[model samples]
Target: MTLKELLGIFERQGIKRIDPMGQKFDHNLHQAVAQIETPDAAAGTVVQVLQAGYTIHDRLLRPAMVGVAAGVMQQVNTSA
Candidate 1:
């Protein structure tokens, strides 16, 4: 069977996908694989999902692997 067909079977049985794209990054729900610079979203937000996670019965089966928006570092000057 095709991949979509196989997945459809599981989805029918209370298996759901955890696609957290464009959502704020949550450590409890998502696993940050890398941080990327993005102006489109706020810092610590999810930019892209490298791997999709899954859930069953509202419980986390696996954490979604994603790339989070990174904050730009600022330089500070100290004067005597």
Candidate 2:
């Protein structure tokens, strides 16, 4: 069977894809490999997914390897 067909079979068996591309970075679901500077999207947004994650039912089978937009984690105005 083709890879697509195999994936379909897995999906039918309750395998779900965790494609969090363009979604907000979640520490619980995603593993941020790098924080890149990108103005194309909001900071902390998932810019790229190195590896797709998977799940079965409500259990997390794997965390997605991703790169998130870079920005100040906590911007503080020192000038008063």
Candidate 3:
């Protein structure tokens, strides 16, 4: 009846949600929509999830749309 109940039914039917937050980026499970430069998290880590992903019985139904963390670029001094 409610959304939570529906989700529970889906879960009972072997549907699982993929949570990518704070996890390492995986091409198979996550689709990187954007890359953000930050020093807070390691590069190639999933920083945000734009869309949730799902799987059924170990088969992926959809990949999670996410934003991956990129290492901050440092300026190189060329002046001698």
Top model number, lDDT: 3
lDDT of 3 at 3: 83
2 or 3, greater by lDDT: 3
Residues 1-80 of candidate 3 have per-residue lDDT tens digits of 99899889989999999999999999999999999998999999999999999999999999999999999999999999
Minimal lDDT window, size 10, model 1:
71-80
Return the clash pairs for model 3, or none. Answer: none
Colliding pairs, model 1: none
The TM-score obtained by model 2 is 0.82
User: Tens-digit lDDT track for model 2 on 4-77?
Assistant: 99889979989888999999999888999999887688998999999998888867889999999987556689
Residue 65 deviation, candidate 2, in Å?
A: 0.3
The most accurate candidate by TM-score is 3
| Global Cα lDDT for candidate 2 | 0.89
Q: How high is the CA lDDT of each candidate model?
A: 0.89, 0.89, 0.96
Candidate numbers, best lDDT first, in rank order: 3, 2, 1
Error of 2 at 70 (Å): 0.7
- Flag clash pairs in model 2: none
**Alpha carbon deviation, residue 47, candidate 2 (Å):** 0.2
Sort by TM-score, top down from the best = 3, 2, 1
